[model samples]
Target: MKKSMLAIGAISILFFSFIATQPKIYAQAGGSSVPFLLISPDARMSGMGETGTAIADDINAIYWNPAGLGFLDYFPKQNPFDENEELRPFRQVALSYSPWLPQFNADLFYSYGTIGQYFDYLQGTVAFNFIFMNLGEFNRTSANGDPMGKFISNEFALGLSYGTIIAPDLSIGAQLRYIQSNLTPTVAGQQDAGNGNSVSFDLGLLWKPQNLPYITDRLSAGFNLKNIGPKITYIRESDPLPTTLNLGLAFNIVKDEYNDLKVAGNFSKLLVKRDSLGSDPLPKSLVTGWDNPGADWSFGLEYWYDQVFALRAGYFTEPSTIGGRQYWNFGAGVKYSIFHVDFSFINTVEANHPLANTMRFSMLIDWR
Candidate 1:
């Protein structure tokens, strides 16, 4: 069966559409493989133009910056509105879903789920996450152009994360993940179609000073180095994982009993290098990749009212050599006792863009 070649082609298409924001080309982000890992899963972060490196405050921190988990409010606080003295959440679970590339209307979808727990003995938070992406159904064909039924394609990842406070005002976190892609099914009488498995890890650090003297402890900074692993192979050809470095800054402009406003900025760079010959191996590529183009950047603002509702807006942009995506994100979120809901919408600058009308929805349950 020639499923490998066709399935391989489809993988590229999905990668570009979902991550690089380019449809026909994989040149962006140095021709990454399994680029789905780069997509921001939670609607809150997606609404913030994927600028969550510094604001990783919820269960979704497992994907943004696990280090934020170390700062979770471990003590169960009293719910003010609950006259029954119900305890507020100290652990969280989140689910995020999106209809990918809705402009294409291809039945494609992506989903993510994560949960976190605090361990007093370990003085840290432990988390787990699962990611799933449906690439839709593909029509199969034989060598003679004969119909050979259809097959569904998909990809998934499983991850575990741990974050702990290493020092005052500082924390460190790590994540390990298993990735798999089922690009095509095996034929009864032929060899298996395209598929692959890989493993990767991430490292992150966050610093939030309580007495910095300048911003009244409102400023925070963080960094995440993600997707550090070996290449993944479908059959013979291998491609580098979408290794990346993310840096972010966040600060509260206003905070009070009834109102809160925060602004965040983020910068990200690809760390995979390739040329006509082949791709450079890890460690080396991390250095050479920087020589190609500038990093992508985004700015976002979030405002919360009485800790019950939020309004968010953000803009993201990148250089032309690096997918050239430019878009605005707007969203709102609501919290009711132990449940939270968030919604986000994308508006692209370019007309008729594949991602022009994409939307994301997320729900969270926090409990003690």
Candidate 2:
């Protein structure tokens, strides 16, 4: 009776925790002035130049797709830490476990995901994740260009994910998350520009079909719906939420225990208020793509060796009608036991954009 009661109590708490996470809404009028936390992170070692479903394994998976954590198979075996293990901390603050420690383990992985299509169970695994992002520090400025104050922007997320062999030749998974964003409010130029707090949730699914007797495990498909939350806005100015629907497909030309190669394509739709996306209203004369209202499609690629090191790259476009701009991405990562670390560099192909040379880092550790 005691055991059963404990199990029921745990379930009740988890259920209520999931409900407590409310969705965020955007302001209606000051549309374009959204917080920078909305920008997605680079999940690929070779910065995928576009936005797509992320396939990440390290602690960073907490940010991209928590479902990837189901792949951890390193439990209940040999010592997770031995004499030769080294402490690895990279540019992004990701923690790499030292093999010298006793019973130490870490898990870090990136998923090769896309926007659409159904994948089967013959391959792939389940996973979990935790993530934190810092938006750097800045001083609040008044209209006269005087320093009014200082503030910071940041985000935190926790996720639970599961993947299963749903069919003889199919594997699938999903993730549920609780996300929070905090951007300090400030008065900028002629108005009070800074925004405050927002809460949201995310859902993701991945599927990989079995390889045919004659065909190799070279192809798979995936999809995800992210940042689907309530509207968030400041005072009189109200904007829609920064919701996005994503779809993608990938091909693995090379796969083995030691090395692998994967290429993928994705499409995304930004579900915010129309006026918030741009200054002018659209006319019937405009014929635009629904997957990416103001942007073009994205392409990404990944390569790995011995599951110890990885490299990635990608490209993204912002259609010509809205003033086209291109992005280039690059990233690299390393894994040791259950600890993993990653770093990525993002920059616009266009030289002069203020957001051009951005950098991101990630870390993950798993111990049971």
Candidate 3:
């Protein structure tokens, strides 16, 4: 199974690399395609204001920050619970389904799945992930208001990720993804209206220090660079991928064996330059885009009881110039043995928002 998983990952990376070399497209403000990639697909992370960069430690880490996978508690050579137990590592699998923007359309939805395992021989953790988005079906019409056939829009991504503990308190990870977006069949005059394929990469770092001199042992920080890739072309226009940089911090405010409280904050900035601005080289554009006006910030709090039940709440804010997605989120989770279930809801502050009253559901299974 391990060899098969690794082989699949290797093949996916190579396949996507070749596809990325094809001609690409560009976009203007709010013009980026494949925007589904930015949506939070994990219920736990969505419940926590989509602040997964620092607080991800489970199978969902494949989406938020693969570096956190390095922290999975695999069964060691000598199991403390059972000394006679075999020396094997634990495996985790997660599945999630979300009815996105139900307030606007009930048929549109998103789904995600991931599997992760630790290999003692490699001293690292590896995971495979898949994401899909269904934008629902729409009636096709010609520019002359003529009736045409119906069409459905969809997008998907296949990815493989790896993470390892590089130091006692630091871990790093990377993921390579193959993304495809199919918008419409044949537009009136535009050629190449079929499917667009692109490849992107994600890099993440996590710093988790324990037993600080005067501080708590539960504090941690994380950084992630996501969606770094070449431009993708739908037909005529070419646009950069939705590259972003995220920085986050998380800490346990109250901790004990029976109960614990945690809080986390994350800030994110788009790294792509605007079309109006003259294009700088890739290296320079990344640095210059830091000063861009569009930025997002989020905060979340969670409380757990006996490690079985959890309650969470969070707030997310973005500048009006940047999309103005201000909202509050709430969620809950329960775990029994190796099975877990989580649910999350989103409430937008602005009236008539597409994401108003959105919700997500997720399930997980773990074996040790």
RMSD of each: 3.1, 14.6, 8.7
TM-score list, all predictions: 0.93, 0.60, 0.87
lDDT of 1 by residue, 138-233 (tens): 778777778778787888999999999999999899999999988777876866557888999999999988898767789999999999999988
Q: Which ten residues in a row have the lowest lDDT in candidate 3?
A: 16-25
Which residue runs of candidate 1 sit more than 4 Å off their true CA positions? 1-11, 14-18, 21-29, 73-76, 79-89, 188-192
Relative to the true structure, candidate 2 has a C-alpha RMSD (angstroms) of 14.6
Q: Report the lDDT of model 1 for residue 53.
A: 96
Backbone clashes under 3 angstroms, per model: 0, 64, 9
Mark the regions of model 2 whose C-alpha exceeds 4 Å error after superposition. 1-37, 42-46, 50-62, 66-196, 276-294, 366-368
| Candidate 2 lDDT over residue span 1-368, tens digit each | 11222232342232212111101211221132232323454444336654345454333333344333333223333444675554322112233211110111111111221111112342333333444544434455555766665655444555545544445534345555555444455444335433433445555555545664655555555556555444455544543444555666777778888988877777755444443354222221112213233534688787789978988888876554433546777877777876556666666776654335555555544342
Encode model 3's per-residue lDDT on 1-368: one tens digit a residue. Answer: 11222232242232222112101112222234466778788888889998889977898988888898888747455446886777667589999998866764437688999998998887888999999987566666655756576766678999999898999989999999999987666666666775688899999999999878777478999999988887667676566677878999999998998999999999988776656553433555578666566678999998899989999999998765655668899999999988889999988898876677888999999866
Error of 2 at 349 (Å): 1.7
lDDT of 2 at 246: 67
How does candidate 2 fare on TM-score?
A: 0.60
Cα shift from native, residue 362, model 1 (Å): 0.3
Residue 112 alpha-carbon offset, candidate 2, angstroms: 20
